[model samples]
Target: MVIPWLSVLWAAPIIGAGVVMLMPRRALAKWVALAVSLLALGVTVVIAAGFDPGGEQYQFVESRRWIPSFGTGYILGVDGIALALIVLTAVLVPLLIVAGWNDADNAAQRRSVHTYLALTLAVEGMVFMSLIALDILLFYVFFEAMLIPMYFLIGGFGADRVASSKAAVKFLLYNLFGGLIMLAAVIGLYVTTAGSDAFGSGTFDFRAIVAAVAAGDFAVNPAVLNLMFAGFMFAFAVKAPLWPLHRWLPDAAVEATPASAVLMMAVMDKVGTFGMLRYCLQLFPDAATLFRPLIITLAVVGIIYGAVVAIGQTDVMRLIAYTSISHFGFIILGIFVMTTQGQSGSTLYMVNHGISTAALFLIAGFLVSRRGSRLIAAYGGVQKVAPVLAGTFLVAGLATLSLPGLAPFISEFLVLIGTFTRYPVLAVLAATALVLSAIYVLWLYQRIMTGPVREGNERLRDLVPRELAVVTPLIVLLLVLGIYPKPALDVIDPAVGHTLTTIDQPDPAPTLADGNAP
Candidate 1:
């Protein structure tokens, strides 16, 4: 039998966290955490090596009973999307640890670094589990459980601990409320599935759930399905922090450390969109179709609103937060468009965004650390003083703006092209944000990095080895993906096709000039 790669991918960090808690020397915990995260990355590489890019089925699947009475089991698997996300989670956690090497100011606080590392590891483990989980109950369990570590990560460590605590509380409350609503949906789905021929027997296996929904085996009411889909969609929306429901993100991201923000924004938030693709579109195709127009409207609104708001922000971190809101809008739009290019573009966007956003946060955090400020006004002529740092920022910023020859551009272009074929007006409206993105990013760079040296800003340091170490990989990835995306897309397309097939949707063919096949 093949090794249980998914279990190993998740368990390494939890085991590492346990070992970290036992470490006699507190300083060693970060190293241990880093080693564990790297190990997880290595395992993911092995999984990828063995992964069949052509296969649409979940790979490395392993299932065992968790609660017989509830028909719940510890089911785990990954498609290309899940594998890519698992890799992202693994890649980011170690960088997060490194970024926080000296986060605590006092000896007392320093002693608790182990706790911080342990909590981070816990989050990594849980996130991996959430990505790979094939049981609805197990998915929900990991989904909700990962938030605890994040709450502490935000609250316990940051530039403003007290304010961070408040943000954490807000984040927790929002997610928990959403999760509870999802729980009701899960129960509702379970009840609808009982005695259904589609599942063979009552089970919380996600595949079975999908099969039941697809076959119309469950005699669920349309109204009930709509309500359940809304619940699931809302929970994910809150997590995506999509407009209106997105209020928690700026607060949490602004208050949290750069590392925390990386996890929160770059890694964790993708779970929300991933759920929309995985469960909502695939399992609740009717509801997804029913709600497409509404979701598309919200996504377009978020794109323009986030870009406009970002242009007005003074705080660097908060501006990035708002920009994420805009980027997420694109991802959402791409997903709801339901075209092959749109789906593939959205999936690719998730990975590309994570890498580019990490470079922004980490480099920005490094700048903030040296200058002791996050306000754009406080920084001036930084490029003159630290050209390398300025260059890094420029590359990352260009990626954010979806400049050609960078990763986001390809994905963004694909999204718009695919969307235009089916959603012409929406595509045009959403494309306006591209100009807005350029304004905010270039304007921010000009204000912070290009002006005459501000008082007390003349002596700012360039990117240190540690900071470079943290950011280099992400930068390399952005360029590599921009230049050559086919490897990733090869893995992603089959899964995208599977999802579209499950939803019984096909890409809309382009109309010929003569209204005939060319």
Candidate 2:
């Protein structure tokens, strides 16, 4: 009998959340949540170990009848793209559990530690489900449901109760509005498929739908398809929090605890970009193609806008939040470029960004907790008092700027190369963020971690063992992946190629200087 790996992978954290909610002691709840997340990580490792990069497009797939009347099923699967994200989510949650060990204690709102841990696990499980679900309805259900726990995380526990509460509401409202639009698209998809001879009756199986669309078996009016595509893309872009639609992200990230904020930015937000790659492109290839230039323009604008705004931020955490908006632009740019390198780099960027952002944000949170302020002016000469903490913060900062020998560098490099090949002007515009990123990152570090020992900063403590445990792995990953990204690229490349094939996009052929085809 074969193991139902995908089912187990998503269910473990969710079930653990229930178990944690039942724990009598807050300490036990914390340990149990950590263990559960580690178990999930172990499961992901096993799946990765068994997975063949060159094998079937979707692996460890599981399907069962569910709501037969509506043609939705309990479908689950992972391609290399989803698998990479699964690994990212799994790896981060355990560290977040440790990093947030005391974040809920003495909350102004009287939030319990157990409740916080349980909610974290709940978000993890739901995110896991969203990444693996092969049924569109199934994906949407978890996609929207994850927001509830996240809302509570933002509102129920934080240093500033009022700000946290307000941010939580903003987060919920924006995502809920997006979800409602996607609901219409979901229903519209079913209606279109049910009316077509291709599916005979409506079905939510993603693979089946993609196959039918590829084979031209599910034909609909182009305008109708475009509308449905817009519905899906709107939700994803909001979730991706693409510019103009991204107002909710900074406030939410600033008001929440560092762990919760990292969870939102690093893990949860990837779903938006993931949905764009997985659903928007495959299900509505023509619509994606039609919207490519417009999306690329928006992405380039976001890249420059986010970096410029980040340089002006007074709050350290909010500064990092703006930087993410910029990094996300790179990810979106890679996806819409419709080249294998672009998509693969975008996918890899998702993972690299998650690691780097989590590291920088959490380290900053640690510093903030010590000084009891998030303002950049609150500290100077931190390195004199806490060299270990300062060093880690510097490394994470460098990684954020995509410095050479950091994980983000290779991914960012790939995105630029991919973008330049097809859209040189836009790529050139986006590349300007590299200089802008260095400016913000180095300036932030100089203000907080350098300068003569500031008053009151003299007694600051260095990273304790627990803090070291939380940050070491992330830094190591940045170094290892930066130096040798080929292992990750090997797993990611084939899936990217498959996605390109499904959308009928071939890499542009090389040409001679005279513009002759090579």
Candidate 3:
């Protein structure tokens, strides 16, 4: 019998968490967590090896009824997009454990090491489940379940314990509010499926909803359908933390440790974009069409707004948080533009952004740990004292600005080219934000890493062996993907093609005459 790899992948981390909790040695928990996370990563590698690249259908599926009355079940599967994200999740969690190991050992955090490691493991499991879940109810369950661990990760262990607590509460409240709105939409979908001739009975499976909606079996009122779309979209928007809905992020990133910040910005935020693609566009094509202009306007506004605001920020972590807001704008624009290049670029951006941002946060953490500060202006002449650290920061900063031959540059270029095909004005406006992004990144790097050596910074140490281990993988990945992104694009394109099929949208072809003239 074939192993249920998706189920096993999700369960491995949780089981490891339990093992860590049961161990008598508290100091050993970090090693245990690292071991567990690596094991999960190994499982993901095996799954990827076995994954079918040519098919659009869900692979490695496992389904069993959980709540029959509502047609809810423990259904799990992955298409190429889901598989790519699963690999990303697997890669980051182990690195998180490694990068945060010192923080976990500090006197301020020594007592809670087990809890911190366990929560990290559990969050990995929850994110994996959310990515693979086929049932809407199951997805929601894992979606909300992941937050509890992260809430504690922020409040109980990070810098400024009291402020961190407030940020955690704010984060929780915002997400819960969004989740509740989505919960209502999920129920509405359930009811529609129950009454549909195509279903004849209720179903919470995402596939069933997509099929029934495509066949017009729901016969839903246009107004009601719009409302349902609004519910899911708003929930995802809040998570995407789109402009104006993004107030919680700067606060959370400012107060949390760099390790926690990486998880939040790099891994967690993708859920919002993932939901927008998997549910919003696929399940509600009409609503997506109706709302496309409004969303594109918001995205363009966010790209400019985030970059402009980031220029004025003094806090290093908070500035990075704002940069993500701009990056997410690109991701969202790619999805809503309803073109294959756009969708694939947006999906690929999620993975590339995660790598680049995590490198930034981890390297930032090392510098902050040495200097005991996160203020961009607090130190100067870092390169004179810590050249290795300065160099790593330069690569990460260059990646953030989407410098050519880096991973982000490729993703950003695709998004612009795709968006330009249909929304040229918005694309041009978004392109201008690339300049603003460059300003913030280069300016920040200049203030922190150049000039004559500051008195205190003269003694600053470069990245130690462990710190090098934490960031080197990310830098290597940036170079690898920058030069040749075909492997990832291959996995992503088929899934994107399937998504466009569900929405009944096709890529707009450009005329040869227009191309030549341009």
**Which has the greatest lDDT?**
2
- Stretches of candidate 2 off by over 4 Å are none
Location of the lowest summed lDDT over 10 successive residues in candidate 1: 102-111
For candidate 1, write residues 210-246 as lDDT tens digits: 8766677666678988998998999999998778789
Q: After superposition, how far is residue 351 of candidate 2 from its true place, in Å?
A: 0.5
lDDT of 2 by residue, 359-468 (tens): 99999999998988899998999999999999999999999999999999989999999998899999999999999999999999999999998888888899999999
Q: What are the Cα lDDT values of the candidates?
A: 0.88, 0.95, 0.88
Which stretches of candidate 3 lie above 4 Å from their native place? 107-111, 512-518
TM-score of 3: 0.98
- The residue-level lDDT of candidate 3 at 336 comes to 94
Which is the better candidate, 2 or 3, if ranked by lDDT? 2
Clashing pairs in 3: none
Q: What local lDDT does model 1 show for residue 400?
A: 97
Q: What would the C-alpha RMSD of candidate 2 be, to one decimal place?
A: 0.8
Ranking by TM-score: 2, 3, 1
Query: Which residue segments of model 1 deviate by more than 4 Å?
Result: 105-111, 195-197, 513-518
Q: What TM-score does each of the candidates earn?
A: 0.97, 0.99, 0.98
lDDT of 2 at 55: 98
lDDT of 3 by residue, 153-238 (tens): 87777767789899999998998999899999988988887877788698998998888777776687878888889999988898
